[model samples]
Target: MSVATESVPVFAIAPAEDGQIAFPPAMEARFRPGLAAVHDEMLAREEVIALLCFGSAPRGEAKPKSDLDVLALTNGTEYWKRSRMINGVEVQLQVGPLQHWREDIEKGNPAMIDAFATGELLFDRTGEATALKRDAEERFRAGPAEPGPKFFQRQRYAITNIVLDLEDMAEDSLEARVLAGFMVLEALRFWCAAQRFWPNRKPWVMLRQLQGRDSSLGAKIESFYTSYSSVHAIAFTDAVLEGVGGRLYELSTDPEPVPS
Candidate 1:
């Protein structure tokens, strides 16, 4: 097989060595100057209200391939754009509507919220950025909810995708199961979130709950992850689907399955 797997995007944050993760002092100094310049330029725009950086670069584990996730929170359809070279990569800026941006913020969006809370602030005005951090933290404190229609839909789509990935991984090709597990946990977390139960964003947390509820099923999923095998993963996913049965729709739809 001559296929080339794309290098993981540096912007996608992953667990790394505790102290080894971070932007270098030189990179920070370099990026801030250009960011500050953009801030000064955009501050005069009436439509632009907030600006924030997202992705792994801010979390301090950026590699050479990270994108500078510049959020331009605007009031309306106002044009806001910027470009510069930073840390040897060409950086571009994005401007978005404030209401829409904040809505995602309220959804407890991990990337943006984590970046804002832990990210270095290049500029702040309108107090919205700070408010976003506050609101996100509060939502986290409020905890994860039950798997509503939206959550169910998302999970269904994810499970379908994972099934496909498992097939692919059987060929010794893709690591989609790793990503699939994350999606499954996300679905479970959202279901829990809808129920106002906050599970920490670690695999072990869900694994623990799964164990308490369905030890065999838990063992199956854990095995797939541990072995990183597609066959085991597919088998485990089948079990999950069977276990879900009529309750599956309840996670996303209205009709609870009538007992057979």
Candidate 2:
């Protein structure tokens, strides 16, 4: 068939010969000058309390395709209109009062909390942002902010329903099963929410995350065929169910017959 299958975005995430994976030096060489410039410009501001070199670049595994995420903790009451770009790299300069940013973190603003928790300190002239970063790490380590019983109850209900729908679609037409896979992904969002796990920005990353819990998840998910046949559809659903069994906390029995 002439049909195309889209591949997930490839990160040039290669480990060195020593099997150690860290920030690739070439990317640092390419990206550092621009980041240094941005740091200088932002630090010169009196209202800017904290500036960080965060996201992929700070983590050091960045590819040329990676965009830099910079956070600015500020004394400004009003929010900035938008993030600006520098040297083909996107700089997310979120300018707001430290208290306001902390409020968002406490409420479990996933992106902000993750960034603040792991971000490298760029310039902390007042030391306030450094304190906030510590607070963010403590909060993040405490995990998912106790999403409550109602949240888990809703997710269990959603998981049961989505499982059943996939079971039914597994016997039907290809179009129907494809739709069911989309529905399965929808159910996974709830599952991730209930787990307080970060939803993978890329779908394939989930398999790696799952592999940490169940090593064979990679092989299990890969059993799904190239054309995405019903065999693959059903197999993928079963693998997902396997992941649910192993990874999810306090799972409800799928009202549908458990995928064999």
Candidate number with greatest TM-score: 2
Q: Which portions of model 1 miss their true places by more than 4 Å? A: 1-37, 43-49, 74-84, 96-100, 103-120, 149-228, 235-260
Which regions of candidate 2 fall more than 4 Å away from where they truly are?
1-27, 146-149, 163-174, 187-195, 225-227, 236-260
Residue 30 error for model 2, in Å? 2.7
Per-residue lDDT over 1-260 for candidate 1, one digit per residue giving the tens place of the 0 to 100 score: 01112431222111122212223243445455455455555555667666666555555555666556566677786555666676555567878776675666566665455545555434444555556655665665554444565655556566656576546653455566465555456444543443444444655655666677767877787787787666666667666655444223323456778999
lDDT of each: 0.55, 0.59
| Candidate 2 accuracy as lDDT | 0.59
43-133 in candidate 2: lDDT tens per residue?
6677876666667777676777777776677877877734556777665555667778778876768777778887776655555666667
Count of residue pairs whose backbone atoms collide, per candidate: 13, 1
Per-prediction TM-score to the true structure, in the order listed: 0.49, 0.69
